[model samples]
Target: METITENQKVRAAKKLKKMFGHVDLRDTSLICPIRDVMAVASDKWSILIVLYLGYFPVLRFNELKKKVYGISNKVLSERLKHLEGDGYLKRTMYPEVPVRVEYKLTDFGHSYLQKLIELTEWAETHKNCVISNRTSYHGS
Candidate 1:
């Protein structure tokens, strides 16, 4: 496995510091908030779920699980709660015999999704280069 060099780590730290405004590298408490926010949005399944929900207004838990492959029920539930807590998603439950639960993006979530779309476009453009770099770095 390739180890990140000190210079690269320093540069990455600088970039993150600039992006996040204030981040104390030494303080665990200082880091948790940023980490939690990232954890809520940064997972592959979460990103895919957001993208899928962007195309549709709402989806049931099972439906979302179907659309997002490789996610377990526990993980999906946790991620959904995290997203909802972060104001990126809203969950509604219907009072009925069978009971229906639905998840949808909030207005805030849609705005964030727009930004994600731009980032996705940028990533798509650079994907080949990124893959080549990764392969080369991993000695594949």
Candidate 2:
């Protein structure tokens, strides 16, 4: 992990406090809504779905399944619905012999993808450090 300066930690805490608006650490009421909203977008399946949708302008259900790899139909369907309901993505249905469906990111989702891209880049940079730490911790 990269070493974070005390100033950086303080700045991050200040930003979080500004966003959360005077949250008390013991108060679950204020935290729950933010946690719920974050959970929908930050789950592994939802992250993959959003990333793939960002990569490809449009994708069908089966195509997403193939790209995401190992997500079950039920979980994918649930995550897609949650993401759509939250305005991150849109789902369109076409009336045809097979009744085709397509998924694509909204402007909101694209904006969120920028954040995800930064996080993915950070993870890529720190992955080796994280692995080494994990190995050392486990060995100890």
Candidate 3:
């Protein structure tokens, strides 16, 4: 395992600043909100859940769990709460003998859904080349 040193990070930041130009590191307030928004979207389950909901709106919790393999209950719950809090998803609870909860993408989430669909289409077209590249790189 290679360790990333502080000097490497500083050099990378400097290079990015030089390449991009006009970066203001002093603007903590501006940076924090962007970071938080990215944190919500960057969760492993959030994008997958959103993509799944884009295809199948109004899915039950168990159905979502089944569709997104390897996600534990606790992590799923947390991801759902985070998405709901961020207004990306709407969580509806039905009153019945046993309560039922369904998750659907909100309008905000649908915007992201469109982008995901485009990405999926692109992936579908290029997947064969991608697989070949991966196989070549891995020497398998």
Using lDDT as the measure, the top candidate is 2
| Tens-digit lDDT string for candidate 3 (44-138) | 68878999998898899999999999999998999999999999999999998699999999999998788778877888988988999999999
- What is the per-residue lDDT of model 1 for residues 21-57, given as tens digits with 9 covering 90 to 100? 6755676787787778887898887898899889889
- What lDDT would each prediction earn against the true structure? 0.89, 0.95, 0.87
Q: Candidate 3: lDDT of 103? A: 96
Clashing pairs in 2: none
Instruction: Point out the worst 10-residue segment of candidate 1 by lDDT.
Output: 19-28
What is the Cα-based TM-score of model 2?
A: 0.93
Specify the poorest-scoring 10-residue window by lDDT in model 2. Answer: 19-28
lDDT for model 3 comes to 0.87
The better-scoring model by TM-score among 2 and 3 is: 2
Which is the leading candidate under TM-score?
A: 2
At residue 27, candidate 2 shows an lDDT of 83
Segments of candidate 2 deviating more than 4 angstroms: none
